[model samples]
Target: MAVTATLTSTERQIGIAISAGLAILGLAMAAVAKTGPMALHGGMALVLGIALVFYLGGALYDHPEPTNRRHAEYYDAPTRFGIVMTLIWAVAGMGVGVWLAALMYWPEATPAVPWTSYGRLRPVHTSGVIFGFGGNALIATSFYVLQRTSRTRLADAVSPWFVLIGFNLFCLWAATGYVMGQTQSKEYAEPEWYADLWLVLVWVTYFVVYIRTLARRAEPHIYVANWYYMAFILVVAMLHIVNNLALPVTWGAGESFTIWSGVQDAMIQWWYGHNAVAFFLTAGFLGMLYYFLPVRAQRPIWSYRLSILSFWGIVFFYMWAGSHHLHYTALPYWVQTLGMTFSVMLLVPSWASAGNAIATLNGAWDKVRDDATLRFMFVAAVFYGLSTFEGSFLAIRPINSLSHFTDWTVGHVHSGTLGWVAMIVFGAIYSLVPKLWGRDDMAWPKAVEWHFWLAIAGTLIYVVSLWNAGITQGLMWRAYDEGGALSYSFIESVEAMLPYYAARTLGGGLFLAGAFLCTVNCRATMRAAGDRVDEADRPLATQPAE
Candidate 1:
């Protein structure tokens, strides 16, 4: 549906003004930079702004104004748009991932170009999947959960669009800027100063939208899902601003130097990095799992107190655990041990949340067996427990010694992201798509089953191969032949990784295929929406006197 059709004339005008302002800003940036990555980035923004301006303006005079009844129903256009963007990024991001994996074994396939180089594209894949795919899913679902749980429509429709579209623009800038080599060299916070600044603006608007809606809620208490989503939003802003503190070389240029240097910078980077995993990847999706798993399984959470315990535990313990990544570095020994301690402690809450989710499915196994959507969530809970255990284990000084630089770390990350994060997202999408589109099931119900297996097979193959590759790399490097010297050369270690890399490539390819199928299935379902409306799916606002 065209979002413009749902907006009031005032809201449309507001959208138009914002779009025009963005267009002017983009033009100024493009004109000032004149050439280079900054200019290209500005040009892209200019196009986006102009396109939105025309999009809103064209509908301004033609569309009928929405009725007051809209307040009695949830605002979901932004959610729909966000879902579509999520799928698009899933394909784009994971596609790049698979290609990168292939390039590991077939190095000759890399295009001899700056943009296609592994260094640049690596962030593209990460940002695309993490920020692009995962971020969009979180935003979309948060809106859905927030409104339903609070028993209110969104505070204002326009701001939700602003947050969703503006956030996507930030994702676009980050991915494109990486390819153009505009970065502060910070992991997960790589976009230069301007992009960071833009995100701060977008994020604050998001925070406001969330808070404003909550303030207007009909429900007396905020839901558990909202708590996790709020934590995701607030903590990420803190992490991003702190780790990305930098001085721009010039206002108009994309170049910037970080204020932090040396070991302090390393500490700051991983502090932001691992917590990005905590809040962004874990907390937000846990919110998703909390809401959707129960709804899909037709059961209440196993323990309300346990859910509370897990939430607080994750928030407290995860902050300390990031330092574990700095183990064996110039970071102080006490700090490293402290990080290790917190990481091990983290398992209690992580498993608590995961176990709570799994236990909730008791007596609902029949539904889980028959429903692929619920199964996605079930597997996600299992993997969440496994990967979190692995994370805590890897944090130990001894285990970190073997796992630190190798693909073992890589495997651990994907197990969380692919196995835990993506699985939960797909489950939410499957459960949501039908309801959102007023359908009883996906356009092709069988496709969901196909996707589940492909995803499972892909995750196993990719993670297992990397686990083997990482162990071999670590063991070979640590091996001794009684000569008090290394037994294997680095080249030999690289050679041994060839087969594993190929397997990882295959695994990634399969996952990408499943994601593509999902995108296509959603498109079909949305097209079939027609006049089928789920009357029960609405807000609880009483009608005002006409």
Candidate 2:
């Protein structure tokens, strides 16, 4: 029989208190929310509150006595839960993304539905993939990496679970609120003041858990991966608070107004936006790459000094590069110039990290060839270099003049997200799933190879088609007739994008399919683990053990 893990006395007490507090707060919110989206969210909060109460109560009653067992040397439960959440959100996010791509070409596909419209669903897709999928992966892997590197278990069990659960709750609120047309109108920071506040609580707890665990490290020196993870955590918290400084219209409502106005607001928004790409997307994943790639490749990082230089370089340069998004806008010319300069300089550190990963795999060419998982990491590093280079070029004033507000920018983002970010995440997932489940390999290792090819093909088609369409649109916008009038009408560009949009939809579908395959493979691996455990527990001779 499988073992049932009951809550400890500390966990039971904390859970009961938190559940009670949430239930009270939910009732208060519901009482105030007379109608609309706020009412819906209040109802949700109330349900969650009640559910948690019963959940904790059951645990308390069923297991009155706390077990005197100690935690393992490394805590893996939260990481396991996080990995499951990551897979789920990946499918949901990418599925929405594919639907959005389809709507671009077939606008009437879901007509007369506000919730399903592109505008609302766009944030859903972006936040779902970025925060839901990528965020979970980072949190999960960071937990796993931190413990193994530090040679210590997570410091506080309750805090880690709280952070993960609370973070997901925030993601749920953000996504469902978007569908309900509730937003503060910031790009990546769209979740209203209430959601933002919840995230702050969760994030602070996450930071505490991380630092506390690090402080108890058995290793004398903190590993390099921890530095990157620290940067990701600290910088993201900083960016989130500054950019999301807003005043809610009322305690019962979802509307809010940002504190910064005009150019200042735009600057802050992109500052938050671009760095969301930096710290949230890039830095955390780099931590994964540094640790997992080296271990998988069975080699040390090529240059510790280079990695240190790149870490600081990325930290300094990325903060200023957000201004590049305001290049031709009302922002000051000097600010734009500074953004461009920092962006160009950023290529150095970006490439350094990418090169470091590739160099680490120099002597592990056989491993890369043999293991599809390692190949995913190799491809991810290449895409990281390529995307960073593309980002630098796009940041230049002249280039931004052409690529700004175009599908080229979209392609550029996917190049990083689908190519670099998602690929590394896949590699890490494949690397982790078997080990976490106590299996020697994936239940179906060949499926990983299929997923890899599908991913590559989908990414290439999506990016290349958009690149062509963007260039075509940009050139046509600038073309002049013999009379010096605009040659191509705006509709012409719209018509031009139809084929590419169809192509993009197909590509997105393929990627989503690959994600589904991963889900199947992972689930099978878990089942296999359970089967193994059952067999191990079975009696061979129908006799009791002495």
Candidate 3:
């Protein structure tokens, strides 16, 4: 084993023991749980808490033992988890989204099934995409980015594993909870009190690990990537806690109720709901795009100043835009106006980053053409620009009047999710796999190009169909006679949407096909990777500053 700056065997053993202990407690609690999920959750907390204690025990006592030898320890494990999970969660999350898409056009698609109903499955789809798929992408890339940018391995051995395993466990509970009809009923803040507590435990440790790693950085300036990542970590922790404010039914196990009531609750919920996208999805992914896109393609960023301008601008503007969802409802006019204004203004900052990314490909046109990874990043920038513009357009009062509560909103989201976020994640995984797996290149480069085409074609079909469907549905609903009476019945509006609905289904089906391709591509790659690695084959990740 190579000597880390602070590696020690005793510390590792203690950490491992603690993790094992907590895991045992969680299993026991889950196995013996009562009715609701809360009992099972406290049991989970016990496990997480003990694991944390053990991990920290190692980090604190496992100092490098005053050894005189200095050596490099390649970070193969971190990247492996990161890359593998990006693909795994992508398939799972996107699968949920496509299923939800089918449910939209077919009311009986759920067939009164409690677990599969729209109300329940909505959270499943949202969390799967946001937390499961997006969350995995964030953790995987953040680990890779922080290590490279800080010029250090993660702060400790057990801690990184704890972060990954603990986070995935949280995701599993979230998806399962949504299906089992357990939710706080707060939009984007649906996970119940226990899930909230679980996230708190996970997020706090994530922030600590981040800080500890940064504290021991070997670089002159903390890379902008790390700054974006840290901001995301800090803000999301605060946002998640504030929004998940529910009074639990009991310490044992049961339902919970929100402290906020009526309009006050509405305001608070949307504030948390929308910002989840801003900080959790946008900020973290932007960090990935900033570091991985350029680094993978062997190009420098277009403009550092532009990046800072956009990053700060997004941070300030996006916090208030969530209320736009509440337009023309219980929210005050000024609140709606402020929400709409900020969302519209969000366009500038969003475009700035998009522009900066696209410009970075200045001399790398050949790479963009030949490299599947670069293609993923390049198209991601394009979609980022498209999604931002569409978002701003949808937030406008005239457009919201038509598209609010329609399939248009869904279409707009997928533009961001499938087009922008998923594409970038695909690029990151392609770049990270070889780096992590200790191979010279992808197990099959051509398959990645195939994955890219499948995703793009599917996305175009999906987004375009919904755009058409949303406008048609919106106009049909508001059709009026000269006497200001309804010209079209609600069912008529539904009827007009049939062809579009079928098209949307087709488009979503195509997206799923591409995702399935990715799953196969990733599985084959993993199988090729045996149990152990040859350290000499590691990629050039940490290099001297240019």
Query: Largest lDDT belongs to which candidate?
Result: 1
- Colliding residue pairs in candidate 3: none
Every model's TM-score: 0.98, 0.95, 0.89
Error of 3 at 354 (Å): 0.3
Q: By TM-score, who's the top model here?
A: 1
**Runs with alpha carbons beyond 4 Å of true place in candidate 3:** 1-8, 24-33, 39-71, 109-113, 530-546
Q: How does each model score on lDDT?
A: 0.92, 0.87, 0.77
lDDT of 2 by residue, 137-211 (tens): 999999999988877667766777778878888899899999998888899898988778878988998998899
Which sections of candidate 1 miss by over 4 Å? 542-546
Clash count per candidate: 0, 0, 0
> Model 2: runs farther than 4 Å from truth?
1-6, 61-69, 530-546
Task: Please write out the lDDT profile of model 1 over residues 11-114, one tens digit for every residue.
Answer: 99999999988888888889988997778878888998899999999999878888888887888888999999999999999999999999999999999998
Tens digits of per-residue lDDT for model 3, 1-546: 222224455545656575666666566556556555655564665667575665556465546562322124444465566556656776777777778777767867677667878787777777877887788778777877887777666665556666777777777777777777777777777777766776788899889988987776767788888878888899999988887788877655546888888987898888887887788878888998999888877988999989999989999999889889888998899999999999999999999999999999999999899888889999999999999999998988888999998889989988998899889888888776765655556677788888899889988988988888888888888889999998999888787788877777777777778777877877777667543444553223333111
**How far does residue 213 in candidate 1 sit from its true spot (Å)?**
0.5
Residue 48, model 1, lDDT: 88
